[model samples]
Target: MVTKIRKSQRIHARIVVMDSDKEAVHQLMRLLGKEGYKVEAIEQINKMLEKIKNEQIDVLILAVEAWDNRGYELIPTIKKMNRFLPIIVTSADDSIETATRVREQGIFFYAIKPLDIKEIKLALKNALSKKFVSSGEALFIQKEEIQKAFDDEILDLADASKILKLSKPTVSKLVRNGELPASRIGNKWYLIRNQLLEWLRVTAAGNQRNYGTLILETMDEGVAVVDRRLKIVSCNSAYLQALDVPRDQIIGEYCYRVSHRSVVPCDESSCPVRQAFRTKRPVKFMHINYDSEGNEHYCDVIALPMKEKDGKVAHVVEIIRDNTETYNLNRHLNWIRSFFAHECRKTLGPIVMNISALVDENLSASISIERRDKMLLSSLCSLKFLHDMIRNYIISCKYETEKLQCNKKSVYVYKNIFPQIIEEFHPILSKKGMDIETEIKGERPIWCDPDFIKIAFSNLINNAVKYGTAKTKIVCWLKMTDDEFEFNILNEGVGIPHDKLYDIFNRFTRFGKLAISGTGLGLHVVKLIVEMHNGTLKAQSGYLIDNKPITYDEFYANENLYKMKDKNLRKFARFILKIPSGEDTQKMEV
Candidate 1:
C-alpha cells in the first residue's frame, strides 16, 4: 500500500503509464487504481504523444527498455507540451548515461528495474506532489491546500505556527535551531508548504534513514563507497568480511590501508576506483585478496564514479564479487591442457620413431616377424591413446558448454550395453587370466541413455584392469529395486587407499606406485556422465585395516580387518552406480 497522507486537493488525479511490456502496464494500472488514481495505460511510444495530448495527465509514468531508444527521445517532447507535468522515468539499463540523462531532464524520479513495487509507488507519489507544489494546480492535493497557497505563497512564522498547531515561540526556536524549514527574511521568519513538509518528513525519518545502507547490508556482493581521499564513507557487511576487519575499526580508516594493507593509495594502473573516477564511468578488474585465516580469495571488482556539482568527480562506489570457484575451475582446466599435451607427445613420438625404424629395417634387410609384430602393437597403443584423448576432450568441452544432451530410451542389459563392455574387456581379462562373473538380480531391460552409460561402464572396467592386480576375479552384476537400477563392478587387486576413495574421481588423479596408461580424466568424465543422468557412483575397497569404521590402509598388520596373524593384506576394489528408474527416465537424462 502507498503511504497515505491527507491531500489538500481532494479531486482524483489522472496518471498515464507508458511501457511496452503488457505485464508492467497491468501491474501499474492495478497499483494506481488501488490508490484512487485513474490510470491510462499506453504501450506504443510513437502514438503516446497523440494519446496524451487529449488527456488531463497529472503524472506520466514511463519505463523504457534499453533497446527502445525512441521511447527515451520522447521525454522532452512530452515535457514541453505540459511544462508542469511531472515525468518519472524508469529504465532497464542502470548505466551512468541513463542516470545522467534523466538528471539533465530534471526528472522528478528515476528508478532502475527490476524495481520494488513500493519504490515505484513512492516515486510516483513524490513526482505527483512535486508537480502539485510547483504548478499550484493542486491536481492531487486537498482543496484547502489550494486556498492556502492562493492566500500567501510564503507563510510567516505566526501563520506556520497556526498551520502546524504549535506555539509561535516553539516555531521560532525550531527555526533558530535549524530544525524547521523556516528562514528569517530581514526580521521575521517565513516558510513554504513544500519546504515545511520536506523538513517534517526528514525530521521524522532522519536524513540517514533514507540512504542506501539498508540495501547494501542485504546484498551478497561486497560494496564500499569512498571519498576522493580514499577514506571509507560507507561499507557493507560483505565488504567488512572481504577486508577481515571490524566495522568500528574500518569506517573512518583509509580504503587503501584496509583493503591493500598499504600506507599509500593504490597503484595507478591497477586501481579500478581511480580509473572509474578518471573515466567518469564504471571500471572493472580482477584481483586476489586474503581472508583473516590466510586463505587466498579471488574477486572481480567493479567501481562506479559519482559526480558532484558542475560534473566534477566526487566519490566512487566499489563492488566485489567472489570468483574463487571459477578461478579454481580454470586452474584445473590448465592442468588438463598440460597433461594432454604430454600424453600427445608421449604417444605420437613412439609411433613416428617406430615407423622410421620399419622403413629402414625393411629396406636395408628382411625384417623379422617378431620385430614387425612389436611395431604393430606400438602403433595400436599410440592410436588408442590419441583416440581416448580426443574423445575425453570433446566430452569435457560439451559439458562445459552445457550442450551435453542425453537421448534416453529403454536399454536391455543383455542385448545393448552389457555385451559390448564384456567383449571389449575380454582381452585384458584373458591376458591376466582373471575370472569375470555376470549376475542379474531382476529384469534385464532398464531405461537410460544407452550410449553414455556404455562409456561410463567401459571406463570403470578399464580402470579396474589398469589398477587391479593380474589373475584376479572380476564381478559385474545388475540389481534392480522398486524404484531404481543398480550396477556394480568389483575386482580383487591392490585397491585404492580408503583416504583417497573420493579424491580419485577428481581430474588428473593417479594412485598407487604403479605407472598407469591414462591421462586420469576417464574417472572424472565418468563422474560427470553419472551426475548428468541424476545418478551416483560410489567407490569402495576392502583391504588390511584396524576395526576403524573407514577401513583405511594406514593400519598396522596387527589390526583386525586384514588377517588374524599375517600382516600382508589382499585388496579388492568395487564401483557401484545407482540410477533412478520406473518413472519417466527420459526426464532424468540431462
Candidate 2:
C-alpha cells in the first residue's frame, strides 16, 4: 500500500541524508528534522547505502560533490530497489553536463550550489505527494532490495511469504524460533510489516538501534540548538565537553557569550549564524574561536535553519567542528616561507652581481687562457643559480603570506623592466648561442611596483635561457589591452612534460626529470607577483616547426583559442602573464 504525507504532522517517516560533504549532511539533517522527521545522516558512501538498504527510508537526499563518482553511482541502485523512492540530487557543479547526467537518473530535482530553503521545501512537498508502489507491484522489483515503511505495515502469512521468499513451514519455524515477529489470529499467522523491518535492522546491526539521546551524546561534532533570541535552548554532550563547561551553566546562556565571550554577535562580516538567519537557509563559515585561556582555534561552523509552520525561524542548529591542528600547521608553514624570503633579499643579491663582474673582466683578457677562464665562468654561473634560487624562495613566501604589497608608480614596461631584464640575461643567452627576439606593441604606462615587475620578467627570461634548447631563438612579446598588460615568453625547449604541466606553478614541485637546475619556485613566484598586480599567468606547451612558430600577431589573432590548435608539432613551452592596470586589491580582514 502507498503512504502519503500532506502535512508535517503526517510525516511519521525517516529521511536518509546520504552525502560525503560534512556540512551538507548536517544542513540536510537539520532541515529534515525540522519537518518532524527521524533523520539518519551518514558520511561514508558505502555506509549510507547500507543504511538505505536496511532501514525504512521515505526520502533520500544526495548532497555530495568535490569527491568522485562513488556517490553518483548509487543513483541507479536506489531506482531499482524502489521505483517510488524520490532522489533529490544536489551539487556545486551546476554545469550543463552535470544537470543532464542528473536528469538521466530521473531525480526529482537538481539543486545547484548554495541551496535555497524554499526550493528544498517545495521539492520535498512534491516528493511526498506521489503515492508509493503497491506490494504486488513492488514484488516484481527484486524483493531482496525492498526495505521500506510499508514492509512493516501489515500482512497475512500468504503475502508475508512473498516478502520473505520462504515457504509457510520455514516462515512458521522462524516465528516459532522468535527470529521474526508474528502472531496467530484465527488459526492463521499474521504480522506487522514494521516489526519485520525492525528485526532486519537489529539483526544487521548486531545490536540495538541508536536514536534520540544515544545518538546525540556520541557525536564528535559539537551541536547546539539556539532560539531566535540567541539563547541556547539545548546542547549535546559534545558541545558541553568541547567548551569544558557544565550543562547547567550552558543550557540557558546566550550562544555568543559561551562561544565568543561577547555580549554582541560573532564577527558581523561573515558569521554563519547571522547569514543563515538572514537568508533563512543553511550557511557555512570558518571562524577563529578562543578558549577561556585565550588560545585561539579554528572552527568550521554550519548553521542550519529550523523554521516553524508559519515560515518563522524557531531555532537554528549549529554544528562546530574543531580544526586547530590544521590552522597551526599552516601558521608554521607561513613563518618558514617568510623567513626564507627575507634571507634571500638581504644576503645573496650582491654576491651574484660581484661574481658576474669578475667573470666579465677575466673573459676580456688580452692574453690566451683556457683553464682560468673556464673556472671563473663556472663560478659565476653557480653564484647566479644560487641568487636566483634564493630570490624565488622569497617571492613564494610573499605570495603565501599575501604580503606582496603593490607600490604602484607610473612606468613604461618596455622602457623600465623589460629592457633591463633583456640586457641582464642577453649575455647568458648569447653564451648559449641563442638570441632573444622582442615584439613590443605601442607601450603604455602601467601602475605597478617596478622592482617586483623586473623580478618577474627576469625570472621568465632566465628560465628560457636555462632550460631552452641551445641555439634556439627565444621570443619575448608584449601587448597592451584597454584594461590589462599581456606578456608572453616563448621558448623552444624539450618542453615541460605533459603529465607535469599542471603542477609547475605549485611551490617546490619539480617537473619530471629535466636536467635544469632550479629551486622550482620561479614560476610560483611569478604567479604570485602577477596576482598581486591583479593579473593572471599560464603555461602552454606545444611545438614549433621548421625554425618558425606562432608569432605575436598569430597568438593575438587566436588568443581566445590558442592553446592546442594542432597536435602534429614539436613541443615548446610558453609562459603568458597578464596584469590589470589600476585594479583594486581585495584584502580580507583577520
Candidate No. with top lDDT: 1
Q: Ten-residue segment with the worst summed lDDT in candidate 2?
A: 132-141
lDDT of 1 by residue, 1-590 (tens): 33333343323566778777778778777876676667888665434554544445667878765225445666655554444557878777889977887768867778887767788777767666554545354544445544544432456688688877889999888777544655343356556656576656655686563366777788888888888877877778788776665564566578777775655776878899889888998999887766556677787878989787788887898887789889978986886787668877888888888777777855426768777767766676567557766677678768877999988777765567788878766645665677678888876456778888888887888778777778866788888655788889887677887788889888767774667667677888888888987999998876623422223443334355434335566677888888876465434432
Provide the TM-score for each candidate, comma-separated: 0.47, 0.43
Q: lDDT of each model, Cα atoms only?
A: 0.70, 0.69
Predictions: Cα RMSD each: 19.1, 20.5
> For residues 1-590, could you state the per-residue lDDT of candidate 2 as single tens digits?
22444444335445677666778778766876676656777555545444555546667878646235445655754554455677888888878987887788888777886888678777776665553333322212234445554443446666667777789788777766434666543345556666566656666675422343356567778888777777876677788788887664565688888876665787655777777777899998988888888888788888998787898787888888888878866865785576457544534555555455556766446334664455455555556666778677766766566776778876778887887787777547656889999998855667789998888988888888887889988898888644678898899887776566678888777754775556677888887788788788888775465655654345446745365554455557889999875533222111
